[model samples]
Target: MELFFKYLQYEKRFSPHTITSYQTDLHQFQEYLQEVYQLEDLKVADHAIIRSWVVTLVQKELDSRTIHRKIASLRSYYRFLVQRGLLETNPTLRIKAPKLAKKLPAFIPEDAFTQLLDQSEFTTDFKGQRERLILELLYGTGMRLAELTTLQLEDINLAASTLKVLGKGNKERILPLNASLINALSHYLQLRSATFPNNNSSFLFVTDKEAPLYPKYVYRVVKKYISTVSTANKNSPHVLRHSFATHLLNRGADLGAIKDLLGHASLAATQVYTHNSIEKLKAIFEKAHPKA
Candidate 1:
């Protein structure tokens, strides 16, 4: 299993978070096989055995999305095994994933973000600079949390006003930095260098101990600031990403351009933001258009 995971990490270029998900799902499936079927070999799993696992997942009343992801993990793993000639056939080929409802992206309004960044105050210190940079990077560049955490100082070209992001699947894309974001980056970098002058880490953001920033700590920073301005139930880092894309669409940014900035492999993944745009258009038409 570790060998398979290494293949995904090195050859497939999958991000750490994705590799972890695949690992968890496969381990769960293996545990089920051990407890229920007295089976220890996942390579020998047949369609009937895999399908029973899906049934058990549904019986447990897990969300359809969770079940869908688990099945997807199995599909990829089996496909990898088959491609390697280790498995005669992919058992997951015959299994169907649970159908999922389409959910619109959740985002804070533009004004709420404006108030958060413009009106909110932070002390003139290292911690304050770090917190502001975290929000600025997530919302400004629309980079994923993992991508932001893994950012190196060289990833940003301050003079060029561009940010090179390492997105999912280890894909790299260059995003233009707006004037405000550029200034924020500059200020944060200055403070970071001054405070951690002797630190050896080259990561753009790090803890007070001069270690690289972790995902949970970054999540807490986003949530803490997001809570100040929005009462939305979903206030995670992804809400800021959705806000970044949806706001761009509302202001007439091209979808393809948005797709590239978001580092999405497909336009279909980017189209989800359009649903929010269409809803905004409907609201405007209902308020302005008058007919007898």
Candidate 2:
């Protein structure tokens, strides 16, 4: 377990937030094993015991996604143990994760997106500028909120109209920016610099005190802006991301290119946006059909 955490820290180069999630998930599994199976050492755990634990998770009515993640955590730990010769075999080798249903992502309409942007521009304060930029980047570049929050001053190149985004698993991807967004970011940077001349914080977005913006702050900004323009069931940064991808897909963007732009590891991951686009097409067909 310690070696696995060290690998996450040094080799995998996982962020502190990701490392913490892995730790919490693993610790929960460990506690379950200790209490139910009286097993203190992971090396002695067997396939049957792991299967039983999965059964308990299902019985608790945990979502397939969460259960799948827990299983993944165990699989990784067992793989590490096997590679290091700490265990003779991986017990999770044949354990199957529950099948997860792919739910379509919710996104706001184009008119609503425009409305949200218009509402966000109502203020001339620093917070207002930052909030507007947050919405623009999410809808413009389709970046994850965490990626946006961690952006550094050097990550953006206005001249090239691109952003150097560090995504999940510490992977780097270059996302394009339009002239309008580039102009907004440039103006924000100037204000940010003038407000804190001696500040050395590398984050692109900062508070009035010049500290880096927290994830919750970004979430709140997204939620506030979305609430004004969208009456959709879901309103969040991820919805904006979905809207960005779905809009691109609707406009005939290649699935592979969208995958690369979103920094998704596989084509399957990016294919979810296609589902949203298909639904939109179905709605249009239903509304336009002449014969009943």
Candidate 3:
């Protein structure tokens, strides 16, 4: 188990968040085996035992997505054990993940974002400027919340009008920026300089005390601003990312380009936005067609 974790951290280069999840899921399964079947070691467990745990998870009403992730963790761990000669066969081989219902990514509308950026009067103070920039960066770059949180000063190149994003799997991608985002960035940098002239942290976005911005702080800021412009059930940073991709798709951006900008590993991840784009087209057709 310790060797498998080291492989994940050092060899696979999985993020700490992902590593924690793997640890938690595996630990939960260990406890389940210990408590339910009085099994002290899972190395001897078989597919039937794994399937029983899946049944237990379903009976407990856990989300299918969550269950799927746990299964994935188990699969990976078992693969490691088999390769290391710790187990003979993989127990999770016959286990299949439950089919998950497809749900479109929630996004704020174009007009809502326009109103938030244009009609809204953000104060010129440090906190106000930083908050405004946070919204713009999320919507502008289509970057993930984690990407935004760890954004550093060197990642942005204002002269080139691009951002260097360290995406999933530690992959680096360059994203272009528009004039509006550049202008917002410039203003925010000015405020940041004035507020923390002797700051030590290299993070682009920081708190009032010049500390690195955390996930919850960014979530609350996004929620507060989005609430003023949208009534979407989810008012998180990823909503802005979805809005960015959806808006670009509506404006005729290519799927491959959107995928690259969003730093998605495959076109399948980017294709979800096409469904949203098609829905918009259907709405337009319904409103304009006269042959009804």
Candidate 4:
């Protein structure tokens, strides 16, 4: 199990968020096996046992995506064991994840973001600058929370006005930095350098103690500011990301170009934003047409 985690972290380069989810799923399944089936070893669990766990998850009314990830985590664990010749066959081979219902991504309106950035007052001090920059990078580049948290100083190319992002599955993509973001980054970098003169950490963002920006802290910072601009239920960093992609699509950005900017493995993942665009069109039509 330890080896599996190390493989995920070191070899597969899974993000902290994903690794945490996998950890929770595996632990829950292991506990279930022990209590319900009197099975101590996951390698000993058969297809029927795995199917029973899936049925239980469905009965509990877990979201399809959550149940899907749990099954995937277990399947990966067993596959790892089998690849190393520890197991004879994969028990999860016959398990099928439930179909997922389509859910449109939530995004902040463009005018709301405009008011948030232009109307809201952010101090010039290090803390204020850092918080503002967090929102800027998330919405400007559409980077994931984990990617922004793990961003290093070396990832930014001031000369080229580009940012090299290490995305999922250890893939790398370069995103163009706009003028506003570039200027904000420049000011923030100066403040960070002056404040941490003696600190040699390479992370782009840091806590007051100069430690790398952890996921929870970043989440809190985003939530705090986003709450002021919008009263939506989701005030997380991901809402900003969705805002970024949706705004771009609404403004006529090409889908393939958006895909590369977002670092999605395929167009299918990026296509979800089109639903939001269609909703926007419907909204505009209803306002313009007077016929009931």
TM, every model:
0.93, 0.87, 0.90, 0.90
Per-prediction RMSD in angstroms?
A: 2.0, 2.9, 2.4, 2.7
Candidate 4 — which residues are off by over 4 angstroms?
280-292
lDDT per residue (tens digit) for residues 35-108 in model 4: 99998888889999999999999999999988989999999999999999999999898988999987889899
Give candidate 3's total backbone clashes: 0
Task: Give the winner by TM-score: 2 or 3.
Answer: 3
- Clashing pairs for model 3 are none
Q: Per-residue lDDT of 1-292 in model 1, one digit per residue for the tens?
A: 8878999999998899989999999999999999999999999789999999999999999989999999999998998888888888888888988889788999998999999988879768999988988898888988888889999999999999998988887788999999988988899989988998898887999999999999999889888999999988888899889999999999889999999999998999999999999877887788888951
**Candidate 2 residue pairs that clash:** none
Whole-model Cα lDDT of every candidate shown, in order = 0.91, 0.86, 0.90, 0.92
Candidate achieving the largest lDDT: 4
Residue pairs in collision within model 1 = none
Structural RMSD, model 2: 2.9
Tell me the number of clashing residue pairs for each predicted model: 0, 0, 0, 0
Across 32-68, the per-residue lDDT of candidate 2 in tens digits comes to: 8899888888778899988988999999999899899
Candidates sorted by TM-score, best first:
1, 4, 3, 2
Which 10 consecutive positions of candidate 4 have the poorest summed lDDT?
283-292
